[model samples]
Target: MTTVTSADGTEIAYDSAGIGPALVLVDGAMCYRAAGPMRPLAALLTSAFTVLTYDRRGRGESGDTQPYAAEREVEDLQAVMRAAGGRAALYAMSSGGALALATAAADPGVTGLVLYEPPFLGGDKEYTARLGELLAAGRRGDAVELFMTTVGVPAPVIAGMRGGPGWSTLEAIAPTLAYDDTLLGDGRVPGELPVSVPMLVVSGTASPAAMQQAAQATAAAFPTAEHRSLAGQTHDVQPDALAPIMIDFLLG
Candidate 1:
């Protein structure tokens, strides 16, 4: 484990492994180095590139400064890239892909990007307002529930998840769910981002049709983007199925 200081002076904790080009793994909502699929995916990619996995601010071992903004998260990623010899490619998951695009746009040091199913389908104004209302009222559990349901979790399944093993952790970082929401910003894919880095946008065939459409829309935003769909995968994509595709786009 290592640490980098963001422009806002927040301490970002990260781990680096394997060797070759610097490749940073960005997590989606409610995930960090310890509690996500990135670790296994990183383990596989390490054979081809140096992999950096980190706790986004307010999650895991990282600090969350007040008045969180998208730019702050961008600086956080830049800080990690600098720590990786001043340049890196990004492999971002879900909303993390939005942050990665923002970072790559700001810093030319980004060599490439591989984004898996960034949820840019559309926005629900009511959900956004309700999420803010829930969080501001300190209803963290409800906030998590709102997010889960908004993302298509079955109501009964979410009810079962409430007291499960990882439910508390999800609630603990529930505020960061708003942070992810801020990145998506009404969910319609932002077509104005000026990222020209080589890019690959992937979606799982078994995932919702909206997710696949979002992936395609996201790919269309970049001139150099390529869109691909993985068979037999869902939002919870298997690491082995993804790692090879990532390697091909990033190294090929």
Candidate 2:
């Protein structure tokens, strides 16, 4: 993986593949290049866009610093955009989608964005408090379970994951879960987007009702955004099912 320096002198590790216009992939909480959905999606889009996938700070091989702020992550993305030849389109899944959108709202260099099921439930402060408490007490596993449960994961499923292979990976990045919560700060829809840059909001046909609503509301919040739902796809959208549609929308 290659590296780029963020505004605060943190080294961000990223893998850039293919050749053409730049496209950056942002994974959700606890996911980075080695352990996330972006790998397949990146391989699928390689022919059309120079796909870039990176470990967000504190995950995978990326560097982390004390006193983390949500804006710092946004700056890390700007650095990635710069490394992508100074401008690029972004396709982000889950919380990464929210971070990408926030960055685009602040920086005009973003050409466009594609967001898949960004969790933007309002009243975020309420949960952040509890999440913070969990983290402060060193209950990392419980913190992970709490976040999973908060996001609608069934209790039985989380219980099943307790001894599963990837539970350690989830617990390893558990603290950053709070950072994800902070990204949507207050969670109310923004009054405006930066310069009305074209965006595409995507949802799966089988995604939870709240996710669908968030996607629609997000599209409506933007002056020039389009929403599309892939039939037979759920929150974990399949790469084969999603790539072609994304390529068409992006290249158009």
Top-lDDT structure, candidate number:
1
Per-residue lDDT over 6-124 for candidate 2, one digit per residue giving the tens place of the 0 to 100 score: 99999999999998899999999878999989999999999999999999998888999768998899999999989988889999998887799888887888888888987776756
C-alpha lDDT of residue 100 in model 1: 94
Model 2 misses residue 22 by how many Å? 0.2
Candidate lDDT values, in order:
0.94, 0.87
What lDDT score is found at residue 216 in candidate 2? 86
Top of the candidates by TM-score: 1
The true-versus-predicted C-alpha distance at residue 56 of model 2, in Å, is: 0.6
Cα lDDT tens digits, model 1, 1-252, are 899999999999999999999999999999999999999999999989999999999999999999999999999999999999989999999999989999988999999999999999788789889999999999999999999998889999999999799899999899999999999998888779889999999999999999999999999888999999999999999999999999998999
TM-score of each: 0.98, 0.96
In candidate 2, stretches whose alpha carbon ends up further than 4 angstroms from where it belongs are none
**lDDT against true structure, model 1:** 0.94
Each prediction's number of clashing residue pairs: 0, 0
TM-score of 2: 0.96
